[model samples]
Target: MTAIKTEVAGRTAAPPPRAPRRRAQGLQGSRKRAGWVMLAPALVHAAVFLLLPMVMLVALSFTDYQFLGAYHWVGIDNFVQLMSDDRWRTALLNTVLYTVVTVPIAMAVALLIALGLNSGIRARGAMRVLYYMPQVTATVAVATVWLWIYQPDVGLANSVLGLFGLPPQGWLTNPNLSLPSLMLVGVWQGLGAKMVVYLAALQSVSRDQLEAAQLDGANRWQTFWNVTWPALGPAHFFVFVTSTIASFQVFDLVFVMTKGGPGSSSTVMTYEIYENAFQGLQLGYAAAQSVVLVVLIGVFTLIGLRLQKVSSDV
Candidate 1:
């Protein structure tokens, strides 16, 4: 009887208060609510602007919408037509070429400039500002400046060529040189931005590892290749992806400089899309082209990520 009474008393002791646990749970719930509240604005903005527009674009790609009148669904006809469009093919090829040429060269030049800036060089701040000026400057302004530089007669480029006894070449007018001339401007414009990214990456490299490499009798190239380059992997991936996207979407320069001419030589995908959408009044076709551009960017990003993974694993 005594044991039973003791056991019943223990059971009826109100079982150690759960108020603390309840309070903790309540705090967590409140925190979650606060987090949601804080995130609401960004979520709403993305929903209304980004997600909605993307959905509209995809929907519009399937219809013959020309910004007026009743539009009928055309299914995949737009995409089918894209497959056979010569201008589309030319634009795609040009875009790919531009991206392929500019990205690596721009990255290399930027990395070199970053290295120079990161070193114990004098006036680095001033140099950095000078290099980064192009990035902050308006694209239209940059394009306009480059237009003057590329003039066939009495241009800076031709004048420099003349100094070396070289004939004055038509930088913008010639079909062969127009694309390359635009590429030179592209590289120059992109350098400052990529350099800034690399500078940040380089600054974060491990000093201890670098010293250890030096102590191990590793030469400059060896230390840099093994230590510095590996440390820059993330930056490399970032620069490559962003540069590729920018290169693929090049337009303002093409517009202000060549206008996709000397027989569509310097025509890019974005320029072609704009021409179709506004000039030709083929919104659906432009939407299809936009879809392709998105897909291409996605593919390139995936490839860069894969390469980064492989390099990291190695």
Candidate 2:
């Protein structure tokens, strides 16, 4: 028996066979090749479309190259000029103000609409379609209709106001109200899409968790605050970051509705960037402003992430 045991032990497990190890090496190499193949198109796309343009924009921002310039380097003079201009200052303020006011209001309205649609309402399907319609509607067409609605006199808005014995006050014509009115239209357009997102997120919520809370004597508000809200972190973050970025880069609405007017009161960053680049033909300054817009959005998004942490923890 001792001899047999020694023989079995000395069989050496055949050194665990190098072929298996070689096979694993081959598999790993294949997986690496697969990953590179999968990434090749995306790499090409980023280089051609995104990275190249960004490099050009950065280069442009450092130069004195206007529309008809003999292309010379200026080294941040465009940026300095931007800081000195009160119009750009107003544009920055309006952009920030629009972002701060609209993102929260739009998100709140979207969340409420989601809650309503998710409560097993009778017309849930139709209601969802209704809410989501604005998301698919053409922005120009929507702006056209809103232009009518905001027409100050003989418009839907003023007509409704007159029913309450109020004067037909200027909506888009008043600088004080133009930005806010745009914010309102933006909210209406944004809420529809955000509502769909929230509804999808709300669907993934566990019925068991909700029922457990119910059994634990939690009211609807308590259950939502304790369960639903926490479960909505991903959707909340997505909606917020996208909406905040959109707010910063609001252009089409401003371009269509008021052309950044009520006397430049609605001149947001993107609109300002467009005006500088195309209208004023200050391409380098516009590039500088675009870079600033990018930086500003990045900083604000970072702040948003921090706030989301605090809110989620609570």
Best by TM-score: 1
Residue runs of model 2 more than 4 Å from their true location after superposition: 1-10, 312-314
TM-score for all models, in order of appearance:
0.95, 0.95
CA shift of 242, model 1, Å: 1.2
Candidate 1 lDDT over 1-314, as tens digits, reads: 99999999989985788899999999999999999999999999999999999999999999988867578999999999999999899999999999999999999999999999999999999999999999999999999888888878868999999999999999999999999999999999999999999999999999999999999999999999999999999999999999999998899999999999989999999999999999988898899999999999999999999999999999
Top lDDT prediction, candidate number: 1
RMSD of each: 2.2, 1.8
lDDT of candidate 2 over 53-129, digit per residue (tens): 99999999998668987778899898999889999999999999999999999999999999999997898999988
List candidate 1 stretches off by more than 4 Å.
Answer: 1-14
